[model samples]
Target: MNDAQALLPEAIWRDRIFNGDWIPALGGSHTFTEPATGEQLGRVGLANADDVTRAAGEARAAQAAWAATDYKERAGVFRRAALLLSKHHNELSTWIVRETGAIRPKADLELREAGAHLLEAAAMLTQPKGQLLASASNQLSIARRVPHGVVGVISPFNFPLILSIRSIAPALATGNAVVHKPDLQTPVSGGVLIARVFEAAGLPKGVLHVLPGGADAGQAMCTDPHIAMIAFTGSTAVGRSIGELAGRHLKKMSLELGGKNSLIVLDDADPDIAAANVAWGAYLHQGQICMASGRILLQRGIADAVIERVVAKARNLPVGDPAGGAVALGPLINARQVQRVHGIVEDSVAAGATLLTGGSYERQFYQPTVLTGVLPGMRCFEEELFGPVASITVFDTDDEAIALASATSGCLALGVITPTLARGMRIADHVPAGHVHINDQTVLAEAHAPFGGGGTSGNGGRHGGAADWDEFTQWQWMTIKTEAPRYPF
Candidate 1:
């Protein structure tokens, strides 16, 4: 039994499957290290453009049979896989913590979200496929949904489990084969683990192929003729390029990109409660999430009190290795990410933001930083820092608050904390973020809820719930005629 304590460090996670065979990666391999300890965990095979071509071709050939399979059979695969994921959470989470630099709780949350994704996909299979339509007399007409053949999924390092699973599970459940490219930094948790669970659950070969790869493989997937769609979750710049590629290829695409989300503390809010929410929203997983509260808007009346409370929490939260579950925050992904995070903070400080309690780092573990006097044009308020830096900007009235909220590339999430729920709702109505939270924090997620972003954050495509069918399938209108007498055309 592979439990948390019994798991060994040297266990290599080498998985690169094409078609039904386990083949060596022609693009060479990459070695991964535990971010907390800098210890070499394992190596993963990297794929090239040729490998993507081969994988997409095989997956395209396999998608027809998978789509024609009985709906019960398809639903069963997800059910069993969901149970298997839960059963193997202990072992998989060990790898998650070491591979992704996530704390135990965060690792567990990923596992739970993954399992929920599978279960939700299973239920989706049995839902109404299409709706009855009104047609001419003496004729029956219906509109139905059809799979998009093969889908290519590209995911990043942070929250690998759900980020990849969100697309993979739904695509497969809806009868589309998948060619997945997980970040080379976290292949095991992102790609290999999903493949293993589905394979164990009796999914046929070639229906799902996970290839740990680089930019070439990703671009190949985007341009590959056999692939019908692309689902990507990462930085905005990469997403924009992929969107362009998908557009050129005329392939269906879903891009969940970056955000510098805002959490607004209204004048009537309880400062202590609002501060707690801000701290959690900004610092969870070292502020690596796309929905992390990078900008905190404080109403001028309660600005000072909330800032003090937030500073105390920032100071008290411990940042270190998360293996033992003692640390509140774990290390950043690596030295490069740490440098990027610190560079953002340094730039923000230089741009007139006052560093309050924390702005330094000990190796990869960045301090839980809090900054004040942040304005619209400052780097901290403008760009998605993607680090544990809470930049607070003060606003006087509702008009000013709404203007501040609307003035950004950040459009993923907006949170407003107010004693009056109606006021919170009123404020939320003016914001253009895809997700709005009243009396809560910015980072909010549910497997059954519709999720995506606005403006730079997304291209108006949504994930989860009814959005799955719209994303993974194309609409087909069918009409039945009783006799040979048809339209004049």
Candidate 2:
């Protein structure tokens, strides 16, 4: 049996959670193998468009009661969910590590982040849902937040647990029913476990539905009139497609798309400190995160020093099956991802980028690669390589650095390394991004922070804190009077 199978009960990874009950998939079951071992871990039901319509209908029916539930009571459900996630961390973490090929630490990070979001959502429920408004003529007038009724959330494989929860928990907390489609690759951690947690937390029946599906289900979610909003986290290509569909359907969209982020090293920065930050940003989670640093820009004065230290770090890093033993890096999600990553490296080399180290892979375990002399147009510098490769391009002036960072709209998150706070902040502001960091790496986010990017990164919609109210709820104006006014005409 695979580690995932050994860790989970046969029933834990069901195909779908429909109207609060686990059911066999309507479309069929899809086999899921552990990427680390290539062993068949288990299977889950693949939901189809029919299932999406049924699930959305059920959610629509349940939304009214859920929305009317006391805010405190709604908060209580998620509060319990947070504790339940903590209580079952061991089992959930194993599913994440084995299924997603995430290192143990990264798996733990997913659990921690997911739990925090649940807690944040609990607090969000009790926040003021409406506010009194001053009107020109009315005696009493108010503007209030109301649930969107039904929200469709589509999550990706990378960082499945947290990415799924960041949208799901808030949508549920704010009194919207949810129909979720988890990426096929990591259904257990992304969908099944979340359903289990919410079920155990006493979430009402038909309030949430978890569907492990593909394009058909996602398409249904986007076009389903009953689903008022669609929250998606995935590649730029897919996000754009979904955004188009949502627009045509006149549905609200929260899209967190991919990024070819950058980490810039200034002349005055310490090479050791800067290199360590770059390595972490580029190689963490095998660089499968949207915020992972895809390009490294070093000023001429510190280029050699930083590149040398980065290359040394990359060469020394361990790569293997995360499930088998302790390794700094784990396999890619599958052979396809491995091929894509290697292809990018080869293409970049042909484009004149010097491969400093690591341009090979054994099975899915890709080596931590370091590339220097990478120009702006090369594949390594231009594309969002979701792999353990650090591609570097040296810059001469701040003007050139800003131009390089601004050349692409892939700056979902950006980092500038400089001890001079004023200089770093100024440079960061010049580059357009959802989030910016000075003296730090690119990949980092809190559960409660308003998260998303501008332009291709997303459409102004955000995913946490007050952004949740904006994303998952609509506004309405109300008026009340002690007596009915006579006709003024």
Candidate 3:
């Protein structure tokens, strides 16, 4: 058995709503299966409205105490949590690999990344980043970031550890109590890992609650009045529904939704670099990512050359067991995702598109696929595929490339590849996306840079980095009138 298998008890961690006490799921118990090997791993309780209420109540009651704790004290707890995560990263990584079908190296990176997030949050306490603006003669204006009270985080399974808890670290660091509902598919890996960190850090049990359930449970959490904010990362369709719900409640929300992201290759672009990075961006995780470069816009002059390079690279990518070091890729999360990707590929071929490489399927594993002669109206280009398929389009000029890149209604991320720095910067300016990368893929995420999309791609607000913490917080402005001014209104 791997370290993760050893650390996690063979007996599944049963779920009961945590409301200062454990109780049975409102519905009943359900079993969870590992996607990589279609074997039953464990069971989790399915929560209903009642459980959401109890969990919200528990979080609400603990909010004040957690908020009252000094920022430095809270940061110290985060530091301890970071230490604990680092110590047991290998175990957590192995769990992530088995549950989510993530390759060992990528899973290991996520483990360390989780610890890094906590450490970064701990460091932010020393520098609150709140500011004091210009003051009038009689008054001094100070702006402070206040917690949102309690936050509901609904995470997806694609990236169990990173996506699941990305919001939690910032929400907790900024004095907000978080109710985290990890995706049912990989709950054990994400939930167990974070729970250990919190326990080692000596956090109050109710400060952070992990509720494992399905969509109904997630809706309950969103609609709960006690939830002051909702931070969600998942499909665009689901994000739209949750966004509407949060809006009805008038709760603060941060959504990192779906992306029909694109990579633009200028006429002068280096085909080798563009092809290699774009292929990696699209096929990583079997192309199951929000910002996967689903669309490739190539300048007419070099379109054929770039296509040749991408086809060769795609042919070389190996798909096999995630546990094996030689494997460069793994299966999709489940049979449903596998079908979805394959269906899209079939539709593309039927629509008069040319398949350069891949397009074969074996169970959950999908060979990397590249398509050219794709039209804008196709589902692959119009909507987020959320799978490992790239639809290629050629453009006549830089203007045309930029237009094609931004043509999709969704614009979470965009990549620009150009030999000249000036042209790359120019193209990036026109593309409407939350995050833009030059000469690189859109998967790039930095701790300090704000992440999220603009337009139909996602909601208005962003997350991560210094700016993201402020997103979960409301500003409380205070003005002190020390002495009487000449003119007082």
lDDT of 2: 0.89
TM-score of 2: 0.97
TM-score of 3: 0.93
List candidate 3 stretches off by more than 4 Å: 1-7, 10-12, 16-24, 133-140, 481-489
For candidate 1, give the lDDT of residue 69: 93
lDDT of 2 by residue, 356-421 (tens): 899999999999999888997899888899999999999999889989988887678899999999
Clash count per candidate: 0, 1, 0
Worst 10 residues of 2 by lDDT: 1-10
- Tens digits of lDDT, candidate 1, 24-142: 78787777788898998787778899889989999999999999999999999999999888777888888898889888999999999999999999998889998789998988999
Worst 10 residues of 1 by lDDT: 3-12
lDDT of each: 0.88, 0.89, 0.79
* Rank by lDDT (best first): 2, 1, 3
Inter-residue clash pairs, candidate 2: 15-45
Give the TM-score ranking, best first: 2, 1, 3
lDDT of 3 by residue, 1-489 (tens): 553644455443565434333457777766777776788877766667777787788888898899888877898998888777777667777778888888888888787777777887887787755788899867888898888899998888887788765788888888888888888888777665565567668788788877777888888888899999998888888999998988898988888888888888888877788888778788878788888888888888888888998888888888887866577788888888878887887887898888888888788878888989988887677777777787898889888888888787778888888869899899889988888989898777766678788656677677778776668789989888977567766
Relative to the unseen true structure, what is the C-alpha lDDT of residue 370 in candidate 2, on a scale of 0 to 100?
93
lDDT of 3: 0.79
Q: Write the number of the candidate with greater TM-score, choosing between 2 and 3.
A: 2
